[model samples]
Target: MRNASDLPPEAAEASASGVERRARWLLVLLAGLLVASAAYLLYARGVFEPTQTLVLVADDAEGVSVGMDLTFSGFPIGRVRRIELGGDGYARILVDVARRDAHWLRESSVFTMERGLVGGTRLRAYTGVLEGPLLPDGAQRQVLRGDALADLPRMVNAARELLEQLKAMTDPDAPLNASLREVRQLLQKANGRDGVLGVLMGNEADRTRVTAALDDVRRLLQRLQGVADRADALVQRTDQRVFGAQGLADDVQASAREARDLLVGLRATLQRVDGVLAEVHGIAVNTRSATQDLDALRVEVEATLRRVDGMILDIQRRWPFSRDAEVKLP
Candidate 1:
């Protein structure tokens, strides 16, 4: 409550109170601004709203950072929150996707980081099927990595090998040169009067031999064709003799008439056979009755034989005949 000018000289010289007051106001203002800025950043990052967390595991986290934007179809939808090394030696990137944008990520979605040869790397999200189920919270997915720089070495090696092979093949002193010389010789031979045949056979004597062989083959082919023609003519003649209208038909008609007469004779014979069969049936009935009587007689005879056998055994036992001797009946 003291006046401003009534302060001590030493305190005035130091200007301690004024400096302390200014510092307090400045701190308060800074604190307020920091809070406001944090709130704005949280809103911008979609942290104030509900979100789902997704983890993307990658072999290398090269160009990614926290709070980096995650774009979907060229639209920003999420941001990376944290990156940690998992126990399995992979980097796990935690991303917070807003609820509204979460629908864009399905279970079938794939994440990839495509690195260009001359430009910055890109983090792309690919949802192959829009009708698939939505990705659940805390989903762990593997991120595919593509690097143009990584494949350059292998491509260069393969190209270098291909170029070396081409160089060897095109060399003037290579085996290909010998083949070219042979081709030139063949072309020159083709322009000669002997033509390609002379080039292949190498001389007139060999060419004459080949020509003779060809003539023999032509003659053989002509003979074969003539034989085939004669065989076809013979087949036609056989068909005319065996199955033509005037040939087999006439024989068939004659045979049919003979068969008709035979059938008429067979009918008359069948009448006589029917009378004989009637007599045979009557005899068969009588034979059946006689067979029954013979069966009864056979049974009686068997019984009599058994009785006689017993009497013979008794007689033999009373006489005490030798085992090998056959007794004669008195």
Candidate 2:
């Protein structure tokens, strides 16, 4: 703690020089550290990195400000650098996207500014197709704004309406309550002695009558069913007698075969008769030739006999009862 005046002149000068040199060195070190820190901060902020400019136009930029992140798929790829009002009274937000993240943006990319109920406003980019054409530098695009608070009134109104409806439904005189009461009454009626039948008939006496009528109908149906069963049995017996192994169809077929055989035999007999008639005609011709005066009479008699034979043949062919009809020639 000696005073500077109590020191020797030379010693004091040397001590002061040393102190000046140390102070200068300390100042230099501090200046270097400050420069390094500033450079690190600039690098971290991506100030020197190459980036592309994107301008987003919006109707309102209430919650959007400079340094706000623009996210893609929840990752920050760009940051808002400036916000200005346009001539059309719209907000123009300028964003600087790093060159590496610029590839994620395409011509069809969509940008949105969303203000939620519980969080700060978010600026988001959506790229549906990565293979689409690249978005050029300084591209100006419209941003869709979504504000959750904008629909608050409508949602409140809807909720109020729902509450009112719930209150009305809870009222004793409400239609829903009335329907519930009717259903409860119906359930009580169903639990009565006649059960659902009493509920349907509306009265105990009517329910009893309906039950009796139902029993009567059931008995009548059973009787009719029994009668139908008997009729079916009779019909089955008749069917067995008429259309079983020795059926009427088989008998008729046998009779038809026998009739066909008779017809064949009759045809053969008719052929033989035709031959005998031919022989008779030859004999008549010979007789007529031998007796010239009786020729005309023989011819007339022969014609009449031919007509009678034809009539007998026709009757035999037409008559179903005369199956054994035979023509005997003299």
Candidate 3:
């Protein structure tokens, strides 16, 4: 064998040619691998597949961006490829859907763009009926927008206007403030010693007069009560004097009983005297020989008359009704 440094020129050239060929083969393999990887990524992205185009129109595309996915039931069915301002001063969003997912877009499908508090804007599609016809190619549809932050300015403006109105009403020269001052004055008057009377009368002197009148009425009522008590006591004493035991009623009753007994005794005595007179008349009519008896009878008769006179004197002393003691003979 020849030494390596002593190798033939043809052998060295052959070895160099082999190395060049291996290096070229390695370069070609790497290039082929890079192309395959790029093709596979494109195929995965659906660049090679057929698709349907849809155009969405909106008033504003504030958060909507290109390449945003259009979803149905949380699954991505299409992507936003472009956004442009239309001639009618509206935003237009272009979308492309793979042919396999294009059936999810129907003729009556609805599309919307919603911005949330947590994430970027989202595009959504809704189909109410699956039995409807499929959406056509390059169809233009209206997009509805729901922005949570949109209504804040109008609500804030309304609240600010309400606050301004409240401030105006509460100012020092406002009607409400004037009314409050008047009410405060009324309350102060009502809190006086005469209370509501002071507020109504508008003068302290008048309130004092009213208080004095009330005091006089109360004193008058006390005086009346004292007079009533005295009257009641007087009436009770009068009743005791008129109707109680050994009172005026008893004295009058005793006097009436005594007078009746006296009248009855006088009547009996007068009857006896009348009987005696009748006997004397009968004797005078029967016998003229009875003259002596008549004379004796005259003496007895005089005695009886004297006794009747003494009885009259006793009656005048006992009863004393009349001063004239005349006894008429009939």
Candidate 4:
């Protein structure tokens, strides 16, 4: 290798110049890379994105810090940018919400800070009505704090009360124990000679009375069955007498036929009587001129009247009931 001292001065100067130029170019490239990386980091952090401010007031901000996310539906929508104690002794949390994600919040949005038993504090936002008016920028709202540890004392008290109730239940003099004793006595009674009846009737005397009553009911039912059988026989005999051959129904039919024949004969007799009455009326109208024919007409009327009397007597004989009948000449 040739030493630099043995080279010409211009060549050495040119070599030095080339190395400087390369070093300058490398520095320039590194500077450009640094600027690009910074720009990418700023973009990723959303430093240039348009945002709205939301102020949440809380009584305490023990676990909340700047850079904490305000989540909506388990997704981060805003970031806490500042926390300050207000003059009214409240902790005010200022959040920067991206303009795009701010639409997820509404006037009805509720913000909460929750500190769980096994995890870090979480900030959450809930919007119930999507159609509500949008939350304006720089709107100050109250934040609700939910701490699992805060309910420890109340839960402990409730657990103590439950344990006390269990202790009282196990005591010998407790109502539950007394009830159990009564149940045991009832079970013993149910297994005794009277069985379940003894338990229901509450005493041996009452059980005996109930048993006697049940036996009486059974005997009465048997008597009623015997009575029902006798009634059925009686109904059979009545049916035979009322509707059998040569029974009351047959006699009634015969009487009805005879009565019908009598009615026909009586109708014919009434027609003959009507003719006689007409002849009499004619005689009465011309009594002077018809004096000789009057005796003949009277004889004819007497014959018709005799026939009517015979028909009435025949009707009275055929009928089931009889009445005194007499024919008189008018």
Candidate 5:
């Protein structure tokens, strides 16, 4: 456990050299760790991965800068690599999208650069259809710029114009004011005389119209009362005629009884007539059977001829008329 001062100069020098070597090794290790950390950070940021280039043209690049992220659904899919002035005088923004994340972008994808009043600008991508065709490498596309405070001046101008219009409408000499004054006058009249009825009939000169209408209503009520009284009397008379002891109902019942008796008599008479008709039909049949004497009938017909000849002779004697039916000519 001797002190280093008691050691030989060679051994002391060798110990010093070994200490120096160790210190140098520690410093080199620290440098290597720093470099490794830096490389890991770059790799996490996707610096080492191969990327596709996209060109975005815009009228303005107010808040856009290099190294800004182009995000889709809040995920960093691409980055703004550079911004340059194009030959057409527009700002041409260059974006670098990594190969893995670039699949989210399609041919129909839309890009926007939005600047807000409260925050820095954001570059965003929107893909309408994930199944659409892929965006080609080095595709030149347009970036739509949107500003949250862009329409503020126009809106203020519109508000000022509307205020002027409202002021004009409220002016003393405006027709709208005249109409409002007339309405106020009408509201005042609504509280007077016949109340709102007078207002409905019209102004001061037409106040009597409401009074006349009231009089007509009174007359109509009186007439209706008279009509009701008359109708009540008529109903009483009708009740007496229909239901009283000496009423038309009693007379109708008596007539109905007489008619029933007459109908019974008529039916009995028709029965008797029907019996007589039956007897006549029987007699006709008997007579037809008894008159089956054809030879006797011919003999009677001869006898009738002789009688008729005698009658003719008597008629000739009595009348002194011509028996000859022949005519003589000169």
Candidate 6:
């Protein structure tokens, strides 16, 4: 190894070429890496890709920032590149959505800015139907916000009202307390000897009166059962006297049967009398044909007497005359 200053200026430069060339090569590699890193960053930011623009208008831009991701279905599809005030004093967010992901957005898609309790603001897209018409480039849409912090005042107010209602209900002077006291009294009454009836009657006197009335009703029902039993026994005795084998009803039935037989005999005698009457009528005609004098009349009278005697005989044959039979004196 020679001294670095031994050669000429140009030669001296060449003599230390190993370390110098290595350092130069290292710097070139570092520069290439830096350029590659910059290209990668630009690609990631979608600066070099073809993109469609969408403008979102909102009332407030509290948590929105440039370079925020616009997510669709939990995947990033666009980036918010600018935020500014519009001519109408509304916030405008200009977003750059890649061409490939632009198809995911629809004309009916809803855009929103939401800030959670812990995270930064997020831009979101909701496409209810993927089959709808595609969202046009450079379209302006309204942004809806559902910021957790923004809703805090309303939530606090609702919570405060609820607490007030709860406190009012728990207060000693509230109607709920009165109802509870009434329920407690009712429960105590229900636990008494009268049970649920005591609670319904509300006082001891009324409950006692109701219990006495129940006892009276029970006694009345028992008396009615005894009366029914006595009535049943009387009916049995009457049945034995009127309808048993050697009872009054049997004698009455025998009398009725004899009376029916007498009536039948009387009806048969009446039929014989009618037949005799027809014969007498024929005899009266014969007498009128024979003579209109007393002789022929005497013959007709004899024939009529014979027919009447036959009728009498038939009556006797049907039913013999009793000893109490009477002959009327004409």
Question: Candidate 2 clashing pairs?
Answer: none
Task: Write one digit per residue (lDDT tens) for candidate 4, span 41-78.
Answer: 99888889999999999999999988999999999999
For each candidate, give its TM-score against the true structure: 0.54, 0.65, 0.46, 0.62, 0.61, 0.62
Q: TM-score: which candidate is best?
A: 2
lDDT of each residue in 1-330, candidate 6, tens digit only: 777777689887776787889999999999999999999999877899999999999999888888899999899999988999989999999999999999999999999999899989999999999999999999999999998897899999999999999999999999999999999988887887779998888788998999999999999999999999999999999899999988989999999999999999999999999999999999988888566587878999999999987777666666656564433325
Cand. 5 TM to true fold: 0.61
RMSD of 3: 20.4
Model 3: residue 25 alpha-carbon error in angstroms: 1.4
Backbone clashes in candidate 1 total: 0
Which 10-residue window in model 3 sums to the lowest lDDT? 320-329
The parts of candidate 2 lying over 4 Å away from their true place are: 1-8, 213-330
Model 5: number of backbone collisions:
0
Could you give the candidate ranking by TM-score, starting with the highest? Answer: 2, 6, 4, 5, 1, 3
Comparing candidate 1 with candidate 4, which one achieves the higher lDDT?
A: 4
| TM-score: model 4 vs. ground truth | 0.62
lDDT of 2 by residue, 143-183 (tens): 99899999999999999999999999999899999999999
Please report how far candidate 1 places residue 267 from its true position, in Å. Answer: 7.8
Q: Is 2 or 5 the stronger prediction by lDDT?
A: 2
User: What is candidate 3's lDDT per residue for 114-201, written digit by digit as tens?
Assistant: 9765688889999999999999999999998877667778889999999999999999999999999999989987886768988887
- In model 1, which regions exceed 4 Å deviation? 1-49, 55-59, 65-68, 71-76, 81-94, 104-110, 126-142, 187-192, 199-203, 241-245, 259-330
Which should have the higher lDDT, number 3 or number 4? 4
- Candidate 4 residue 41 Cα shift, in angstroms, is 3.4
What clash count does candidate 2 reach? 0
- What TM-score, to 2 decimals, does candidate 6 have? 0.62
Give the candidate number with the greatest lDDT.
Answer: 2
